[model samples]
Target: MPDQQRHVAILGAGIAGLSAAYYINEELGPAAHVTLLEAAPQCGGWCQTMPQQGNSWFECGPRSFRAANGLETLRLVHLVGLQHSILLADRRMAMARFVFLQGKLMKMGPVSAIRQIGVWNLLRETFVPRRSHSEDDESVYAFAERRFGTGLATLLSAMLTGIFAGDAKLLSVRAVFPLLTELEDTYGCVLLGALCKMVAQAAKAVAARLTGPRRRSLAVAEQWAKEMKRKSLVISALPAYVLADILQASTLHTGANGMDPQAIMVQCVNTLRAIPFSSVAVVGFGLQAEQCPWPRSQMGFGYLIPPSEGQEILGTLMESCTFPDAQPSNVTRVTCMIGKAEHLQGSEAHLVAVAQKALERHLGLCITTGQSAVGVAVETLWTAVVVQRRCIPQYTTGHTKRVAQLQELLHLNAPQLSLAGQSYSGVGVNDAIRVSRELVQLLKKNWA
Candidate 1:
């Protein structure tokens, strides 16, 4: 590089972009100048936290972090100085998640090691393990039924529907569950696959202990280091298609700047457009603490409605119970996600009414008619966030090939550029952080 100090432009100030900026600055020290740009006024795209009256907080998106094996998430929380702010959901509470099935809520307990190894599920696991296909390949329904049988598939349908708000029958299995494909490829049976995973995890634990924490915790640290090495690098963390469009436009200009811009932009656009995404909405409702049906001691994470139930709302998270600071002592917060993007007509009144009814039916709690008024208390607040269209990239069937193509294109045209976000790898926050760190390292090796 001409100089150790370089200026980098990071597009979109979401968690990925922020992580990029933090890494770039930390790795390069004062030598790197990082500017993070967000089309929106604020950063934290879907990870924003809004203040409620009193000492309460309301998350606009991403309410809780899963603690089971979330090293990257823990690292990020510490890196962002939110360790103290981290609230753990009470695991002991009888927080049974209910999936809406056949017009009634069926108790779906939290996933555990034993539950995952049921004999019936194991028998079917050998021949019908969870597998991913290409975009044009088998659908989620087909893949689920094949691996877990119709019963498990039907059971999972509601949970899947709630999370993605997508139709498993139509959604590409490859795009939805890529890990299952890896499990099948590796072990050929879900049970064996899970066993192998357990063994691998045990091995990793032993290795980590033997090597010490410093060596084991380098994924994010190393990534941050790489981003620090680049000058004038653009971190386009938006959806792939959006990045693609920008890249395509840049390719059209004539001149040294135009050519370089066009070449880089084209590569980005092409890579992003190749991935697919699914849109979803999460609508939250606030009820008076006194009116809550479930006792305070019984509170925990809320319920998820399966697709077979044909309910409008996907699932509800016990926001108040999940996070103590999420609401006031006298207030209760319940978040309902409208999973079916196709069914959303984008009407607040309609969404609110649907959510209210679902809550009444499942939780047996009614939302006072007056509470339906907009701009009410945080406990009574309702919000609907719609991702008009998104790319649902799964690590299934030809995922490796598609990623390989993306990598090859980047290598040929924009060697210094890398893509990171939920669309590329995993959808969870940890996944995003992990991928971002990896990309940072790659950028450092090439540009630094």
Candidate 2:
């Protein structure tokens, strides 16, 4: 630890890496020299926004975020001065969701969703006995099936397919939905834990109303100032496999820490490589508003197809319904997501046709394959197909344990290096920003 400035090399320029760089600069100011390195020519990674003519745009990646859990994302948005461009989905529009079960689209309102999962089965979850203590991690589906029965587990699997584009049978409940696991661990029942949390949150809200808002004192700043010593730092926000490749090719130093750096690297690299990923193809379609056959009653956030349906596409998002300003008033936008890494072998046109066929089957739309409004009622304004290979990290069973091991190895062998991004803890814009801020604060506190 010295008074001199330190160099902070941040790998990747994705949302997580960008957030890390921004936070470090804001926290350390002139005390650290931040360098952002990206393998791609452009930043933002999977958060790609493609522009179309007529002042419209297509979100080839994640279209909208859950506002309730996106406090960090909102803070970042305000910091970057894009607050004015923000659009909120209508409350009703956001709630109306559908699932392509059987042959037709079934609207999943609160009651219908519960009925689909069986209300008796859900009620029985609280009475279900908790499992005995075990070190091994379980799949999301297994955890659900154990507590809530097969109905709930099946629904969870379908829901997870939409979120992670991954098989819920393979996804780790501890890594993917830690809150669910934590609830079960703490209360022996997820429902009981949720009810307790709600009551506690309500109590806190009432207390806050009477006491007014809490004030931040200068003690935090004083502590940070005292710990603001200089130290070299390398924050990696790259994919786990990519980072493993980089580390495997690089040299390391064993210091006086007495840990075997070579052994640590080998284990770390193996763990990183073991973290699997899922690819997806996002097919965006823009159609004339007048020509669109989707009814107003059916208008809402688009539908998700469960694996039981044996469909080629994962789901579709009604972009125009969610974000009205994203397209012109005359244009209706929708995006189809095709999951599975192996399904992305054909050309972009072939992918577009596949998406179109799915839409035709589910939505009963008259559309041609890879053609724009040729003898079709739905006048196609434009179409875009983006195939993202190995994009979403699949936190499979034992993912949490593997990550813990990787962190321990890095802490012992390479104290200067740290990992962040969707590959590690959480996977979302909000999670990225939140972890980046947290990592920066931790680095500031332990800079020496």
Candidate 3:
């Protein structure tokens, strides 16, 4: 069969799906006919950038991209001719992260010196025992506490909340922070493992500089065509539950050839549905330059509130500080993320008010009590609110095992089907690109 006869149906138009389509087109070219399916009117999934009243930009979803695991994303940027538009924030500026503790926004310094985390706790982690070989998956909180100390474990909970908007006590340590677990499993200690890895990375970087990068050539068109027997490829980048719902509907129509295939599909669907998702309310505010209460020196990426603080907001990001180009010179922008699934049920105005109160308590920002009100707090020139329900997937305990099972079932019963997106692997723009590109590479290899 000719390569041109092959068809690829990509479900969802999110970053993962789009990247998969792009890479498939780039690598396979006319070899494959790609059909991108998106249920929504707009694409981009949870990555929406909106224009504010003051010519500022408010991200209704994800705001910034991290450098780590972002090489593929950067490559995509260059491929799409967006390299010049990129704005780089100072490394120091991006590194300054704060944690709200005991009604104070505390600057979280290095773990070794931070009094909140305790110097003794750091010293004690080295002597802490590792998990037994028979032991399997455990909650993030449990792993942290067992490896480090209770204080550090508590802090990890807050950090997890900021990232996943999830409870660390429920999140899977192996699934969420695989590197950390691998370090412990291999080196018997997290800190020691990290240091060793850093040294290895430095050595690797030096070696890379000494010898330039080497690119591999793609397989010839003729070879690919000959190897390609699969007529259609279906890559699903939808949320786990959505995909499960789809599978559920499809299975009802499938004629059961045997009990095994039908049973596998049912198991996969149930596992997919079991994966929980967390909701978040992204509230953005555009303010005049003078209205920002904090001095420029004190401003950093933003602050995160630990669940211990008993605050409504998960965290706040200083958007203008990190990406000055995102907003006009006269305007400053900041975003607050409130992630309590129940709280999202409130009206938009009510949610805005909640965010306003949070900002006021955390950053001393002004709040509008009535139609007309004045106070020491600085008022916002404009406000933007976006409530994302069941947005972030929660990698609860046994997530990795569940994913492994799902993969095994799919491989046996549905070889043409593949899964990608935050639901399966890492959650970020970089992860999305990396996963999609990898899937395309795998498809190419299979066909070749």
Candidate 4:
């Protein structure tokens, strides 16, 4: 590694690439020159934000990211001097989550959600010792069901809906929720592991006080181990505490896939392809104030429809309510999403009509009920359909090992090149930023 000017060409001008470029420009100063390339002409990747004549803003991709993911991206946002653009969802709606069950949308408040999913089930997960796979990985459903009950395991499907647009049964617990896997692996039980780890940390701190500098290195090693054991998905929108064990499990390991090296690498890639990616169809609608109605249960950011309920659209975001400044005072922008990739293959007009019908059905709105507004014309609907084909990555079973193998292969075959984005690591905005940060650091070592 040299401390001189270097030209870095980054593929995919998404958030990850852009974040890398930004960090290099600011951190490395003129020592690094970044050329970000994307197959598409535009940047921002799936975090697209479109604004029109009024204050109304429409997003074909993600509207907002979870604040808990990390401060890296938020710091980047401020570094670029875009802090004023930030918008927070209404407090009442922010924590509210909903799922379709028992023939209607049920608010997943603590009482109802605990009753529906059973708190004892989670307790079982916390207390019970679950089996581990030394060679293979487990699906999200299987992993959760073994520790937690089937109810909470299946409920994880709703959370995955907003992410992979795929099924939780198919998602890899080790990949998507690696923190849980590591916890289970370390102590045989996640909760017990956490309790022991905390106790051990306290004991180590006391030892450091007695041993001084000699024990400092041991403490540092232990701290690194603790960090290695905890990697979050960065964009955790749900209650992160509930998913306390789910964290990053990225580490270099071999022989986990199988004994055969070449066959395992091939199988690893095949597994990557085998992991299904769902196409999301988003309808961004600009509605008059009278069109959008705020329901009591729909007070939160938005609601997610579980696969059990079986609906065309995944969920609806109360855009106006969530980001009040994104819309005009006289208008409320509603965002409706259909996780099915092929749904938007139909005519745009047909898609708009279908979305309107869905909004009416799910949210109980009169906007499109005949949409039946007195003087509002049907043409004023101003609906736009965004079909994102395979934008999200599905972390199927064995994903962590597969990713580790892929990294190994890259190191062996293409040492100079690296992969970064939602596909390789976590699929949140902050995840991308963190990946980019790591990438820049690596490049500094390689090209500085």
Candidate 5:
């Protein structure tokens, strides 16, 4: 019999969706029919970088992609010959991060974190077992507390809170910080695993210098080339409830449609719907440099606000300092975030006001109450707000098991379906593009 026609339907138009569609057409060849579906009229989903008045730019979604783990997005850009369009932040921003702890913006420099969480305690824990039982998955809080005690755990919580914007007590260590868990599992201790890897890598480097590079066979060379050729594309908006309805309909086949139930699609959709999401608000304020409360010397990178500090805002980014083109020299462009922004009801203005109040409470030195009023601390100059409701997925407890089950369900029931998003894997833009590229290659090899 003739081979069944292959048609791939991609839901959403965010970075992952676009990347998948692009790869299906580019890598899989034109034989496959690929339909890119996006509920939003525009593409790029949350990876939007818009222009502020004048020549400056403001990112509505993710501002910067880290240049770690192969820097796939940068390679993708270079491959597309759009190198000039790519942007890089200041070196200081890339190297250092700050956290707002104990009512101060504590610079997370090379030696600074020791002041907050002692290195001696962390060192002592490293010699001990990371977990009594590695089989059971643990929350980020539980996992960190077990390995490094409460002080280190608190700091880790704040750091991760800056990353996921999810409550540390709820996030799964195996899901969110997979590397840390991998270290513990492989070496029976977290630090030992890391140390061994470093030593092994150094030894390998010396051996490679002695033995020289190994030549690859034709097939191996071709495979390596294919993997190296990075690509891009994305999905936009489609509410979870709407997606769930479609999945349910596809599963039951109880409606007017005579089609059989798509069991795989049902399971895949159900698994996706199970992941919890958090709402985040990014409030951008452009102000004169003198009007800012943070000292010029201390502003290498923006500061993250720990939830334990009882602050209303989650974190603040120094857009102007990091991305110089984000604002004019005379103006300082700073953006503050409000995690769980959905819980509060009001307009964007209200969210901005809350963030401003928090900012004043933390950074300002008032004459009377120590809290500067709105428009006084940050000096809001025609602010813009981007509210992402149910944006970042929270990989809560039992997430590792949930993901394993999800993989099995997709592989067996819905072989044609693929999931790539902040919900399943890493939330960065690099992850979206890299995962899609790898998945497309796999699909191509298995297309027969």
Candidate 6:
């Protein structure tokens, strides 16, 4: 093959796009010309950080992520030279979260720990699993209730509602929790499947240790460097619908749609309109170290409030406890989230009031109108981060056939393009990273 320079245009500057640029440039080197473009002025779409007063910081999107997914994120952090800045949660101090059941906050405790163990219920949940007759028709709520019983389902529904700001009954189980579905299919019960999976994972870890670090798609530093070089990519790391529009506008020709590509693209984009994201105002209140309500010595992550409580704000995070250096000396940072998508039409003042009430209810802490009493209070912080992702893309009955059709259309019509993102697989930072990496490889093999 000739050493022809491959010019790749990346559409968005989000994590996925940035990661793609890095991979293409670093792995492909001078053989590829990578350009990264953003619709917004800045990079880090949702992963943005802003300075707060007196050694405090605020994250517009994700503050911290668990390292459970593997070393991809850790590698990125180290490659970005943020290793020293990485703050690990104090595991011992980290308390189990609670649900706002009925009207009170109930701490999450194992049945044994809570001293309310139902042996029959536990046995059924552990051994018996519900089987779905249809391939792609079960909702998240139905699946959960079937597998874990009503109590666990209710508890999880509350938590997931807060996470996705979505209706549990409408969300697809396959799209939202593919692993869970797989476990049920393979082992009949989630608990049994998990036990088996854990044993296999342990064996794999041992094998990996013996084998040493395997070659990844691309190193983090290389990816970063490539991202810096690209002006933009034609397609993006955004949802398929979003990319479809861009592709239609671009010079790229899709034979399937023929002369009416733009119209077809619009139809595609409109086919699965994103679930309206709720505007959330995250208010952080800082109190003097002496006035902090929770244990000062015992550092740990904060708690969440379930919907059953009829609370305004979703949850609060104990910033000082969750991350070291999150707050200054003699100051405690409490983060509160208000105005979820479900309540987007609610007034800002109403949201704030609800947040205040929730804070009081959960932590026995009050937010007073005193500058001296409150070190900092960020009101109505603007963040475009959508709360309700059209999670569980409507994979109705015969959804597999539909996806297969779409795949066929893409191959036959738009060979230069590939669909990727949270919608295709799962929604998580790690999942997005994995998909983007795979897409990059696909692009290289086909277009490069």
Best by TM-score: 2
* Sliding window of 10 residues with minimal summed lDDT for model 3: 213-222
Sort by lDDT, top down from the best: 2, 3, 5, 4, 1, 6
Q: Which 10 residues in a row give candidate 4 its minimum summed lDDT?
A: 232-241
> Which scores better on TM-score, 2 or 6?
2
Off by over 4 Å in 4: 1-4, 126-129, 132-135, 195-275, 290-292, 370-381, 446-448
- Model 2's alpha-carbon lDDT is 0.77
Between 3 and 6, whose TM-score is larger?
3
Estimate, for each residue in 38-131, the C-alpha lDDT of model 4 and write its tens digit: 6677887877877744556678886677667657878888889998888766766666767766556777877886786687875776677667
lDDT of 6: 0.56
Compose the digit string of candidate 1's lDDT tens values, residues 1-448.
3456677778778778888887776665676677787888888877777665545555666656666757887887898799998776766432555555566555555453225325576575676633344333566677677777666666656656545555667655544565565456657766677676777676864553333311222333334444334336666677776777777665433423345655645555665676666655556655554434554433566666656666777777777765655466667777777646555656767767777787767665567543332233324544444333453443334444465566555544554455676665556677677766765665566564
In the predicted model 5, the residue pairs found to clash are: 12-235, 13-234, 13-235, 13-236, 14-234, 14-235, 14-236, 18-233, 18-234, 19-233
TM-score between model 2 and native: 0.89
lDDT score, candidate 3: 0.76
Give each model's whole-structure lDDT.
0.60, 0.77, 0.76, 0.63, 0.65, 0.56
The residue-by-residue lDDT of candidate 6 on 249-343, one tens digit each, is: 65534456354665545544544233233345666655554444543432346655545556777667677666555565556666776645555
Estimated TM-score per prediction?
0.78, 0.89, 0.88, 0.79, 0.82, 0.77
Model 4, position 87: C-alpha lDDT score: 74
Give, for candidate 6, the lowest lDDT window spanning 10 residues.
212-221
lDDT at 5, model 6: 66
Query: What RMSD does each model have against the real structure?
Result: 6.3, 5.3, 5.2, 9.0, 7.1, 6.8
On lDDT, the leading prediction is 2
Candidate 6 local Cα displacement, residue 128, angstroms:
4.2
Instruction: Give per-residue CA lDDT, model 2, range 30-124, as digits (tens).
Output: 87888899989899999998887656777868767777878899898899889998888866778888888777788887787788778888888
- For model 5, what is the alpha-carbon lDDT of residue 84? 92
